[model samples]
Target: MKLTREEITAALVGLLGADSVIVEPVRMDPYLREPRKRFHQPAAAIALPHDVPALQALARWANEHRVPLIPQGGNTGLVGGQVPLGENEVVVSLVRLDKVRALNAEAGHMTLEAGVVLETAQSLAADAGALFPLYLASQGSARIGGVLSSNAGGVQVLAYGNARELCLGVEAVLADGRLYQGLGSLRKDNTGYDLKDLLIGAEGTLGFITAATLKLFPMPQGHETALCSVNSPEAALALFYDMRRRAAGTLTAFEIIPAFGLDIQLRHRMLDRDPTAGPSPWYCLLEISRPAGGPEGTLMAALEAAFESGGVDDAVIAESLEERARMWAFREQMSECQSREGASIKHDVSVPIAAVPELIARGSEAAVNLLPGIRPCPFGHMGDGNIHFNFSQPVDADPKAFMAGAEPIHAAIYEIVVGLGGSVSAEHGIGQLKTGLLASVKDPVALQMMAAIKAALDPHGILNPGKLLPPSP
Candidate 1:
């Protein structure tokens, strides 16, 4: 026989004090509310362990009782990964574990506790005269543990790589309460299978990430940002290739935005002023980092070459830090601005950087074919080809009615993505949001391997019971 909610709460409170275990529904409200608001099921209780030992104790207690425990950090994930899946589960929040365990800028890495906010981690590196280089829109509230658990990829991924690459090592508590102490700052270790990679993007299905050793880069002397106007996705792609060829690894970000995105942001007053050079069919926000003692005008020279070659229609280079912020604000506020317009369906998908134009063209065309007058807002990391393919409600359409018609649009988009060798869930992990989609599109052999590994690590299925992996075939 299994324990009831009351019994589970009592057991958790026994491991952690009553102050740490929140059984009341009202007090658990904050942890329950996810950013996307898609998954609404309530968790039985919220467990806020004070440190690693307390968390291990709580996990051990829950594992023995077969009580599902959902590990959460920051609670800022777009997919339903960080939220409760069912009423029987308990959310183990690492928010109280915020700490900077170690910082060694000279050695090019830092050890941070899971609860340290993403922005705080960046600031810590900046204080040490280094750069963390994992720039995310939700970094202000997204914590280290959740970021690593999700294996987040943000704007600077073109050069710095994703959360998985940026993370050198991790410390996690397994489903059965054993801690995996893999936090080593070494660059090369060919001893055995990479357990850190397994846990980084596991979405709490196998273990709860308690801390991480993150790779850092030398702080750039300055940044050169530009918003270039392009006539079409093809032109944007050409420009991206040109920029990459010219700037190479120095090219930090290459984000593409549609006119629809610009319209929504301006309408919502999300930006103080327009950041683009002028109106066009599309815009590319490309940036380059200036290394210490490096010559200026590398980005400008590249842009000049693009203009000469007719790859860019027009461009506005950020002359000041304020201009740079506004330019990035226009890019970062893409998702929030869509919400202001009304109901929008979002897909965090990716294709090859070269195939981006085809993906956007076919995806948008399919979406339009399915629903006449559907507004497509295909924007985001063009350098890495991860577009947040989103669709806004038709003019004057009811939000509920529009959302009701999301299935066909999703099907059209995913079919094209898979056909073109693109990913259905690019930056966002296969949380509850895309488990069904993952099953349909992911390779059967890959799924089998995932299930086998999951079974090996979390035989009890007590950690994030219904997330990431799908039901076995």
Candidate 2:
């Protein structure tokens, strides 16, 4: 026997009070709509649990009834993970759980509630004379819970690391409503199977991340930012090696961008002025953080060496904070600028650091061959090997038609990426969008292990029902 929609709604209202549960269709729009505007299925209700106990009660009931629950934070996830996949599902928004539970700037750790905004966490760290380096374009709205759940990697991953590395522990509600109190500031804990790591990147399939203990760092005194022109990806790679040799640990960020990226940004009025030194085939936006007593001119000296080696053709080092911001603006605006051109197909993939040039070259050629005049805008964390391989539709092509024919293009790109010993997904987790893709690319034994873990933690299949894992055969 199953509960009807009205029964589900009334039960939720009873458990969490009428104010916390939303059953009206119009009022559910904000929680229902995801960033990509894909996956538009109606939810039975939107559950806004006011605290940890309320959330636990809701999860307990959902599990017992075998009702699916989708854990959402900020609704900024690019994939449809935060949105409902079926009408019977309930979206459990964690927005009201926002809080700063504890902060120890000197100890290099802070415990933050899942709903705390990423930007707010950064500010809290900065105010305490520390820095939270996990930055993203959507940081303003992307909450800590989803950030960790997705295991997000931002620009500075070259030095600091991704969300998984920055996090020390997590506090989550299991599928059966049992709280996993794993929060801590410990740098070493060899007790067991590392449950914190599992929940951090689990995509809410096993548990709901209610809060986390995140690692922080001492604020850098300043940053040396530059946008350098390179003849090719190979040249950029060589320069990257040289920069690493020179700066080593101080090298915080090294991003790559194509000329197509700049042209579109300027054409679409996304930037007030061009941020590059001059016209070039490609560009590398590199930055070095200076410590309290660190030497200056590190970036300039590295570039001079790169210029002598012909790895860098031209460069512009930021003489002021404004110039530095413009350089970063050029890098951060890469994804949004592509939309102005028209419909675009995007892949978040990664290869070995040394294989990135080959990945770009082969990927671009394959895309052009498939669709003539299709502009390839392959750019992103070049230092970390994750290239946001995006292709803008052919000029004057129908957006609908171009999008309809995306399967062949995706197949072409993924084939090349896998052939080069790369991953199909790098930073973005296997949300609803990539579950099938994950099944195809992932190792058979690995999939079995994941299934076993899911079965153990969520036997009723109530937690994020249709996400991360592919359908059972």
Candidate 3:
């Protein structure tokens, strides 16, 4: 039998102390609202456990009562996975678990509790003369657990991999309150099944991550930053090919942007100044990390070759550290600047690296055909083929109307993405936002296997119900 909201609160208070439970609505608002503001389900209560054992007890109680629990970190997730799905659920904030359990710079790994903020982890690695490569805009607010849960990919994913690649192992609380002590710092441990990978991107539908052993890298001497003006996405793709050919491993970031994005930023006064070479419809921001003893100007030498070959029309290399920051600010501020315009439709999708040009060209044309004057601002990690395909509303159009017609616009763009062999959701996981879309596009057998795994791990379905996976038949 299901329990009432009062019963759920009573049971949780019985397991943990009454002081640990938060039933009042106003105080629970922050934990309920996600970064996207797309999901608005009210949770029955907000549970804050001070330690691992307390968290385990709450999970066990939640499981016995078949009550859903949404595990959250710093609550910076783009998707709605970190927030509650329905009134029956409870949001379990892990902020109290913040602690650096162990750090081994020589071993190139560190064990951190789930609630350790991503920026803090980076600081820890830097203090130890090492580097943690998972950099994101929300790093200041996003915690390790949510980062690994989403398998977030920032601009540097071109050099270092996503959160899953950066993470070695995780210590989590499984359904029914059993602790999963799978944290390992070994280079290679081929033990039975790789539970770490499964849990990393499961988006909390699988288990509640408590701590993690994350992989670190040797600090680079510096970086070579440049803003290249390409005629179009085709030219940008060609430039990326040349950069990859010359600077194979050191090529860390290759981002693409449109002049419209810069215009919006400048109009909104988001950037100090324009960072591009001049006025062009498109630009490619490329960078390469110079090793401790490696020669500098490697990127400069390659850019010279591309310019000679007519692949790049114009380019500006950063002459100082401040200049490099300015160039990156132009790229990083793309998403926020869009909000200055109006309600924008957003899609984070990825295609084959080679098909990126076709994806952008075809997608932009289709969106325009659907909604004339729909400002297309498709930009992101070009090297990895993930484009944050977004569209600002037509000038003076009602925001509500624009959002109401977003579904057809989404269909048009997604049709092109699927035709070119692209993923519907990349970097961002399938939260409540994309459950229907995932069910439509994913393979039937793969879906079944996922359901089986989820059922096996969480037979009670008390872990983040109605989030990543679709409802069982």
TM-score, model 3 to reference: 0.98
Q: Lowest summed-lDDT stretch of 10 residues in model 1?
A: 464-473
* Candidate 1 lDDT score relative to the true structure: 0.91
Local distance difference test, each candidate: 0.91, 0.93, 0.91
Candidate 1 C-alpha lDDT tens digits along 356-375:
99999999999998889999
Ranking by TM-score: 2, 1, 3
Writing each residue's lDDT as its tens digit, candidate 3 over 98-171 gives 98999999899999999999999999999999999988988899999899988899999988889988988899
Model 2 misplacement above 4 A:
none
Worst 10 residues of 2 by lDDT: 32-41
Instruction: Tell me the tens digit of each residue's lDDT in model 2 across 1-473.
Output: 77888999999999999999998889998998887776788999999999999999999999999999999998888878889988888999999999899999999999999999999999999999999999899999999999999999999999999999999999999999999999988999999899999988888899999999999999999999999999899999999999999999999999999999999999999999998999999999999999889999999998898888888999999999999999999999988889889999999999999999999999999999999999999999999999999999999999999999999889999999999999998998888999999899999999999999999999999999889998887
Give the TM-score of each candidate.
Answer: 0.99, 0.99, 0.98
Best by lDDT: 2
lDDT of 2 at 382: 92
Off by over 4 Å in 1: none
After TM-score superposition, what is the CA distance of residue 50 in candidate 1 from its true location, in Å? 1.0
Clashing residue pairs in candidate 3, if any?
none
Q: Tell how far residue 307 is off in model 2, in angstroms.
A: 1.3
Q: Could you tell me the TM-score of candidate 1?
A: 0.99
